[model samples]
Target chain A: MANTMLHINHIAKTFNPGTITEKKALLDVELTLNEGDFVTVIGGNGAGKSTMLNAVAGVFPVDSGKIEIGGVDVTHLPEYKRAKYLGRVFQDPMTGTAATMNIEENMALAMRRGQPRGLKWGIRPMEREMYREQLRTLGLGLEDRMQSKVGLLSGGQRQALTLLMATLKTPKLLLLDEHTAALDPKTAAKVLELTEKIVAEQKLTAMMVTHNMKDAIAIGNRLIMMNAGRIVVDVSGERKKNLTRAEVMGLFEKAAGEELDGDRLLLS
Target chain B: MEIIKLINALPGCVSQGVIWGIMAIGVYITYRILDVADLTVDGSIATGGAVATVLLMAGVNPWIALIVAFVVGMLTGLATGIFHTFMGIPAILAGILTQLSLYSVNLAILGKANLPLNATKLELLISQRNVRALSLDNPLIVLAIVTAGVIALLYLFFGTELGCSLRATGANNAMARAQGINTNTNKVLGLMLSNGLVALSGALLCQYQGFTDVGMGRGAIVIGLAAVIIGEVLFSKIFNNFALKLLAVSIGAVIYFVVIQVVLWLGLDTDFLKMLQALVVAVFLAIPYWKGKYFNKKTGKGA
Candidate 1:
């Protein structure tokens, strides 16, 4: 059965009104992710990739339109209310983990997502073992440093920790907003590989926004390219499989009717 | 050469320092741990004292009255967090709003410009005058009670599931949200706890000083911040561990008190203490950024 994991319909966002600086961040944008859909979103700067993620996450009230996850209408819900159904990671390494907390504690927080919190220590003996096994999957040897404060970890290590934490609850949809942008090139590649392995293993519906075109083509079952606050191109299956860096760039130029000048997008 | 003399002159230094220590613990939760500047401490201290004294006047038990003060403090803190998280107000403005409102609340509770608790309220812990023969003037006994209570509570609270989430929220709110921890709730909770503790200290101070003036909390946030920053810079240098920062903060409060005596003995105007506070805080706050930006590569590497 092809169950839909997420649906975005006719969403539009405009900043400021009756003022000189009104700018629209998203416009009549529509997107849908079937169960286990791994959609890679690629666009240049101001392409509304992050804004779209923020809108879906309810960072704030969007101007209009509907967002559904697991067939439930969640467009007007606050971020905290919708949190149980979605897991997220941001671009900055520092944004995703409490730097002062131990690695194990961070994992426990993610594991207990949406559960009633209390004054007791969050992680127990059984939970510790579960966290260790999960950390092992990263192959980053973080299990041995469970008690170590996460702030001490390198950028790559923190991002890897974030990925594990995000999927721990098996959220209905996972949002990764340039989750690897802060890492060095080599570490970013490694983390991306880990992202794929985990997405495949969990079979979780995922949306990832990235600037790198090769990663855009290589990582997911579907590719979505956005520009001027709209989904400019959508590719899947055989067409998506053969997507090249050059073809993605050509479509951006054709849809926007101008050569892209910003360094926000990588072109070959 | 005169450290011992400085300690002798500031008889209330230990007890006063401990009270400041509790407030520092609050400062720590919001500023150091949460990474948000909260200006509510100034109003909250007065709010705690006012609530406690008012409750005592209404015939509430001394201990129970103190708890009431803490509750008021929490509400004030919650208001501050709500401003930032829900109303989209800047964090500083959010704190300022709560702080301004707390001023009127304190005035109403006191029923006058100040509330005198020495005539009305019991000492925080009932001391047995003959049990150990330690006089009321003994600073060690005072420090002992306050320190033990604060350390135990902080250790217990920060170790809990909610506490870790609070710390994580301050450390990185986005990550806290990613993990399904509500940063808004945590922020509000953290402010409430921080101000709650600060006001509890204020209640203690009122009894210790004989009164809770409407302005007693003036410049208090600065004093607490100075103690906290001084503590972190000195302690992190030696302990080199995250968990030990609490202990370091306690020691820092003690050091700040001891230094106050030295400044007093040097004939520095008591009125100028606030200026001295600003200087000390400026130095320590810059220490970490300096150490990271300059000394880390030159001297060595460690956080």
Candidate 2:
């Protein structure tokens, strides 16, 4: 039996509770991922896709549910403490890496994730060879410019570096929140390919949130559709592999009781 | 107008600048590395002097007095850190509050507004009386060795795993947290380290000048900033290494004092020196913003 890597039980989150601007971002969301389960999450604007991911990452406290990663209860743990169990990539490239630091330094930071940072040197001489090998896999020529500041890189390069950094330690779970959404079409496709390659090579359990509908159907072994604040459609195995865009939309409309209203979703 | 008079004052100005260079380095940690405009230095510098002077008067070893001043300075930073991080106050306001309260604290330590250190009777670490001397007692020689030691230690610290996390915390708070670094803890640690150095500088300054005054550190933030900006503007391109960057800051302090001396020699009133320092810093600080706004080449609109 596959071990459960992530267990999010009946979690709910509300932003600015009791205020006029209060928005219910997540409502009774529940999810469980087995080891090596690559799940793709899709939703319209204001849906709870990102909120659910953030809850799992411990970005904010859930109002009334427990989150466990690798069988460890972490519902009340702060973001930094919970970071030990997960790797995260944000939508904006700039949000994932320190611009002022060099590529090797950024990777060195990620390499030490979940470990106590002591008085030891940040990057050992031997570690530089490892970083160089990893950068070579990205094929962006970053290995030659290890000393170059990350601020000098383009958006796609930064996103690729972020992906490498996120999975550098083989995280128990990876959370990608529309990481390629900010890149141009060609760059986005490249990053998506890299993400798929890395996920499979590491045999890592991962959750990816994407705005592209085709990517949702094409990339992961399982597909989950969310509407409002709940999961509406879930399909995996042979059923998920054969899922078409129109059928997914039909399932969403039937479960949600409304036609999808997101123009960006439709156009993409 | 006399060239010989101006030449005679150069050594004194260099010694004062070197001492303040240590304080400016403290500013660089908070301002440049930690990305905080910590105003706590304004009061903590005097707090260092007060603590050191009092200890020296009690027949304590000068080095031990300096160490105590450094520790007290770190305590002041811890107070500001608690206010900013634990209590959720804005960093600037937290610094200001600590600085304001430190005034009373400094006065209490000295038990008066000013305390004089009779250098002839007490064995001092560094004194202006020997600034021009070629012997080991010369303030410049001692200051040079001290400043180099500081730069070497800081370079090593910043290379450590803990130090990199502090730099990441300043460079990008969001990214730092994602990498499992406790950013609040790092911020507090950085503030403490910065203020400890500032207080050490204050101790040295008091001993060198033979007195500690409550108002001696007035406008210190401006002078520190001037030194930092001057250093960056002059040596940023060439001094990319961490140790060299710190060295540039010390050199920048020397240049700042040299400029002030030149102005004074040009018959400028000593009272206007503060105004002059403020203006110079303000102008240097604004140059980057103005260049980014006005000097960029116009790129065509995106497709």
Candidate 3:
């Protein structure tokens, strides 16, 4: 059995369809993730990593495609309708938290997503303890500062919090779109480490898009490179383990029929 | 001083203040909380007032009319929210379109450009006259009711799951979504609740003013923004709690009205009201940036 947590088949997305500005952001794309599969996606700007994740999340209608999670077809579902099956962390740290709300309050929101969120279960003591335990796992000393506004948290802390939020319900898949690129080097490393820890602990099938080739190779079980709206390379198993930055660059060049452009792939 | 005359007009100003202050709270919901500026409030306010007046004229109980006005306002808000989230309309543009459409809707409901309630025959405020014992114009009683209603609602809501999701949608729609919160639904609900309150304010306002003019909601969003800015600037430290946000906004409305009244008393022509409103908002809006840059240089805090 495939045991796939997610599958994207024959997906295509065209922006500004039929207009002068019409652009093909994603051309016929196909991918599948076995349960517990940790996949890293790499691409140049406009190469469709984000677009693929967006399609899976149903941000907008895919020009053409079928999306399935846990054997359920969701090609026609909207973003909100599909939310119960997926957790998404945006590229912007600021995009994942409410600034004025206290940390616990923010978490409470994340904890209650997709359910009929109501006043009856507004973070009881047990839930607070649960949140504290989750925060403690992050090892960011956030357990003690549950009342602090999330705005006060550093980018790394917020990203980590977002990671926890994404996995809170153990959805079939978690979509992380360069969730740590904006942070400082130290913070990025910490968040990435937390990302690894949570995915392993939860055994979640996840797709993370990263600009950092080193981290991509270092973190996930599989790595896919894309250029010109299609997957250029997909590596996994022992092959993925033996991959290096140079080999990945070579694959990109082969797929694009060109030399690797000036280094935009984050090297850390 | 001219300020005393402004103070004498305090009730009228505060009455207007609370009315728009509630609208400000509505604005704050969309603008500050939901990170949306649902201009539907401008129309929703008139909608509320129009509903209240029509129902009152139809011999509905005053309180029932108030509730109906709120429901009508919420429907208007829902329309805007649905357009923005489901239809993919930008928030600002969505609000503008809804506001424009509401003008026709309001006229349709009122059967004309406006509706007027005969204040004398209407049930006055409890403070102005005892319901059974006395007869006095009771705008203050209604003011207290609105103030109390807003505060209670805010307190009750911020603690709810749906409510928190709504707040998170404003703060971080992505986060809200990742956590299983449907931001679109929350945005729609938040806008509805916000404009609903604003509509209530409008309903009461029309009753208090004895008339509902088609143009009464002109620049309503600005007034609401002004009240919210002023309140946050003046009471940041005092009302940091979610429960206090509504009260602070109410006071902001009162303060805004008082300032306008004072200016009007000082021989400034009423024609300058709009200009003065802009200047006041501009000054207050600059405060945070000013404090962040200059004042904070020494004190280590933003304006």
Candidate 4:
């Protein structure tokens, strides 16, 4: 009886079709997330994991199928239009925030997402205190440097800021595409912890793509594995809660009919 | 080189620089804020002059003529924007295409290579004859007031939410789109605003010189860029405020003209002035790139 936050039905995508370097990135991929469900996605290289997330985010049009967020058909909506219903964090730290703008300006832009931007002042004086409060919660001491340009921030700090910006409006679905992959180990762990806390605090429906098998099994309430442009394994509830890395690998091997070949995935 | 002659010319040079400084502010919007090197200024400036001249000759009010020129100039930007965004042309090429097409548009508007406004018969806002005047009729005084007005208006506009979106669109396109900004529309809006200001400068320049020549704006983009680079090189560190930065660009234009005047007085041939201007701009533009490439030590590992 739960509301469905996202419904991606039979989507397929082909990059550079009919060319010498054609790539079938996604094929007949179907996914649905109930309200408050957190799903973690895992796959080897060339699997449709990130593609699925991008598909849902409307980065590109699907070759086939319909996408709906909050029961609104969004199949033909452009990425910016679809952004009204989704919060997304990219793997690259530079992809989420405007580097030249100050910290408060970036947050101000995010806070007005999906709303009509007019000739009124971009950042009101009252909003500065709110931004300071939010930055304080990050515990990175960014609260004291609200006027500092984002380009001066380290990669981890930018990613953390991007995470904060993404969740500021409590989006119906949060898409994290290897958002912590580029950070150092300690920072990655810290960001991951923050991600879990924010998602729980907001009780947001979310999908996360990760290469680390441990994180894939450990974080979310549901797990979906993709390979060869299709979902190869899906486990949830009690089964996913008790799932181990070895057991997930066994399941991937059984479904894929081959050994997991991503060394980075296995090593991580 | 008579010192008295040079002193007499200095005021005129300053007046000319301030007039062109308005055009350079237009250039700053595209080149600095929107991060586009729009070549459409060359054609659009001339278009403004031609439109204003033709309108003035028809006995229309000069102020109304300037406004009409500004609106027409915005149309030129619209053409380039459509070419770049809707038609999928690259930004630089789109500007070039618009510039080329505007050559014919300018000719059609003027009906000749030159159009003159008789300042004696017409009540013009500014003129070169009053360049040395110390009274209210002095072109320098009027131009300074106009330039200050332009900077104040732009400062206010850029602080608005819509303006912030435009700035974000230029700073990081991907991030802007992800934040629900329609970047294409913002880009078009930026282009229109820039070319409108450029055209307004053109109208003022035509009224000041009392004539509009088809070739008056030939190297306009270069001059605008020279002013922008000179301004940033000289004042970027101290002029952190938005209005002050615009003032810097205007002052930069004045410096450019004063330097040219000095070079002219130092026995430089008038025939070689264009080449000298080009060289000055090239060197100024290269300084930052060279500093980044040759002076700075590599600090971080390559990704």
Number of the top lDDT candidate: 2
Worst 10 residues of 3 chain B by lDDT: B126-135
Pairs in clash, predicted candidate 2 = none
TM-score of chain A of 2: 0.98
Candidate 2, A1-268: lDDT as tens digits: 9999999899888999999999999888888899999999998877888899888887788999899999999998988998898899999999999999999999999999988999999999999999999999999999999999999999999999999999999899999999989999999999999999999999999999988999999998999988878988888989999999889888888998987675935427
Q: What is the lDDT of residue A94 in candidate 2?
A: 98
lDDT of 1 by residue, A59-160 (tens): 878988999999999998878778889988889988888887889988888887877679988677899999999998889999899999999999999999
Superposed model 3: Cα runs more than 4 Å off: A17-22, A245-268, B1-7, B86-89, B111-116, B126-138, B289-303
Docking class of 3: medium
Q: Rank the candidate models, highest lDDT first.
A: 2, 4, 3, 1
Error of 4 at B31 (Å): 1.2
Give lDDT tens digits, candidate 3, residues A1-268: 6598888898999999899999899998999999999999988877888989989988888888788988999899767768888887888988877778888887777676667776774677788989999899998899999999988998888888888877877788989999989999999989888888888999889999998888899888999988878998999999999998889888888888988774655444
Model 1 residue A45 distance off true place after TM-score fit, in angstroms: 2.7
Off by over 4 Å in 4: A262-267, B295-303
**Interface RMSD values for the candidates, listed in order?**
1.5, 0.5, 1.9, 0.6
TM-score of chain A of 1: 0.95
- Between prediction 1 and prediction 3, the one with superior DockQ is 1
Work out how many backbone clashes candidate 2 has.
0
lDDT of 3 at A151: 89
